[model samples]
Target chain A: MTAKKIHPGAPGLLFLALFLLLSLPISLRAGEALVSGQYLSAVGQDIKMQITVAGPAPGTLIVIQNLPIGTVIDTASPAFNQYDAGKGEVKWLLTHVSPGRYIVNLRLLSPLAPGGISGEIRYKNPANGRLINLPVRP
Target chain B: MDSEKPLAGGIPMVNIDGARIRRIREEKGLTQLYVATVVGVTTDTISRWENRRYPNIKKENALKLAEALEIQLADIIDHGPPTTPPTEAPSLLSGEPSKQEAPEPQPAGQEQAIPLEATAPPTAIRANHRLASRPVVLFGAFLLLTLSCLALFWWSTANDGENQVAAVRTLPAHATPGITFPVVIEVTTTSSRSFSLILKETLPPDCIPAQGKPQFVSQASDPPILKWIGKITGEHTVYCYLAKLRPEAKMDTVHQFTGGVTVRSDDNPSIPVSGTDSLQVSPFHWADSNSDGRIDDEELLSVYETYGGIEGLHFGKKLIEEIWASKGYRFNPETRSYEILQ
Candidate 1:
């Protein structure tokens, strides 16, 4: 029988190294998840929005922040939902947003998770459903 | 395989093998009908073989079809293992080949096609397509319902049963003592409903409503005109109301209109006067010191200097030339006094 060779402190040392590396990124980015999606335009009057998260965990709360002034949330008809994590599509509807430039921030929150995601979408009108680029502030 | 062969007088079919058929169909930019008409076969047969509907097309005919369609025979005849049969064959079709039959009936070069005649009318199909795309239709209906409720609430509040009337009084300038001055009161209705007018005054037997109690003239479309002649001068309050009676019914529902005015009595005493004897006095007793007005300066200045430079000469100047103008008075140069003409 051949004797098996094993490194004495390899497993414990490897786990410690991984734990340290993971902790660094989590500390750097905390409180919110990073999200990205497309702003889809409807065939009718108002514009529609579709958002997706890259790796969304269960029980994550999402909120849209940083709306333009005088832009009211149409609570009369608010459409928002979370998609299956594997499916990768969530949709929200906003009506009578008026004609102007706006920056919509998508924020994600989790009770147990260390970090979350946030993304921005710009909405424009008149040219049917054109997606314009929005400059992000530092 | 035999059923996959093209039939005569039927729609023309493309004889290319599976691979070549797919390639040519995509390149020609023609639908399954185009290929079906080019060769003599049903579009279904073309779809079946191209999609590998049969185990295999006979080797000889497969080659003939490939040559006609100008494609390699092997590409059309896939030699790979047969696709596994679906777990459950759809219940709709019976006795059809379990694995080889088309899962959905499709045309020859077309992956999935419905005959134009069998398909829904264009208008109905378009409506259905639009309806399916709009998943927010229910939300829109709910929003309309909420708006209607709000409109109803506004309508109910606007029609609340209440009527209001307002009155304001204005007096004319420079009114004569013991004489009536025009006092105009503007009345306006501030309610959606309409009412009638009832004006009552505390008159001293002398002053009346110009007409009588329950006067109907004020209720007319235009504001009623009334003139009050002063009898006794002091403060007097006039009470008026809008006597709103239901249409075609007689009930005096008085809406009070109250106002007051101050009148000066003629019993106030006048200043007493005494005459001073002045020798070589000017014929005109009252003289204008500023010489700008008739006699306004006499009341302002107590002492007066004559234009002749005479000093220490006093004269009692009377503002009124005669006390009884109604009894007729005329100035007499000889007597140097005003006396009754009669």
Candidate 2:
């Protein structure tokens, strides 16, 4: 009996097709951005929260951080950010952000743990003025 | 030669797209001297017209220019201009001779009743290498991707040959759902002799053909293939078509256009179009002609002028009107519509 020679990469092509098919939506998608926050280990009474803004180009982002009742920010990198010590709030207004991971670090002076610290990333897409609000997560 | 008509407080002075003028001239195989001769202007003036150095010209001259180009006056108007103050005011009504053009006697009783300037000596104007180089650079980067696309079919296809045909596609920077946008394919062949050729354009799955210049030969094909059959004559040929995006197209997705120029040959037939071929769809309307997101009065007027007569196509004019009238707007993802903001 004689058998026909089959293309060895036939399965590979199928996977390639599948991979492209899966990524099609991702490739063709409009601008969708997200901001995430995670708490790093604390030293003494100082607590740190790392904020990440991930998105495409030309994004003007306004990220707001709400601290626990008694939390006061010691300092924040990118000195231009606004932090109200009395209100226990921090706001970072980022303009014309290029695509990539943008980091904003916040160090808080508080006796309380980071149990109730909350924040959100807001972006007003110029194309449609759709205010995108994504909550930061651990 | 679109002359800017000044308007009081409210509206901006009309401006012409210099880059577009240059493209039209280059695409039509018209030299600066030819246009200058017909329009009775120096090649330097013609060059300036094509370079935005003279964005506004007298309406009379514009009409002559429109006549010289064999296109309508409206076709040359810059539908979109920056909202900010114009960097430089157009050198209106100035035909001041630059050192570039030599003086020549005008022929009496020539076809047109306009003063003729010295024809550009043999070489009318130097090609704007800066504008030309960018596309070459972009095409160089995408040449690999297009070749890879060709390679997908290369296993059984004959794509091995010296590249003599080059093509560049001009697409609007942005495409909005439910609107038709123009696409131009510029094919330049090094060959002097005319030869039969097949130009195949592969549109995104969400795009359907609205109109074709010579009309596509192929009736239907999956993935929405558009083919134009014609002879490759002269050094350059331009093919154009309008593709309408589905009204419900998913936004933010990258849509790619892949195509090849297949000449009548046995060895090397297909040469893939090389350049930026992908465009993303947004909720913005195509009527936002200048692509500033919000449709304005002039842009809306242009929309009516360019696309109003087409039957069975609703370019979301009402929504555009609402957006245009409103102070601001936002796109609601849930409703898939633009809501007017106060």
Strongest candidate by DockQ: 2
Each candidate's lDDT (Cα)? 0.34, 0.64
Task: Please compute the TM-score of chain B alone for each predicted structure, in the order given.
Answer: 0.20, 0.41
lDDT digits (tens) for residues B236-337 of candidate 2: 887778887777787777789999876654235457887769878876665564656676544544444334334434445556656655555666667756
Instruction: For residue B23, give model 1's deviation from the true position in Å.
Output: 3.9
True contacts kept of 2: 0.00
Write model 2 residue lDDT over A1-138, tens digit each, in one string: 999897999999999999999988886565544445565633435445555655533245566667765566666765525555566667665644555566666665655554566666766544455556667644
Give lDDT tens digits, candidate 1, residues A12-124: 99999999899978865542323334444322223333444333221121223222222333331244432223322232223223223333333332111211222243333
For residues B272-309, write the lDDT of model 1, one tens digit per residue: 11111111112222232222223321211212111111
The TM-score of candidate 1 is: 0.15
Among the numbered candidates, top TM-score falls to 2
Q: Where is the poorest 10-residue window by lDDT in model 1 chain B? A: B265-274
DockQ of each: 0.00, 0.02
Each model's TM-score, in the order given?
A: 0.15, 0.31
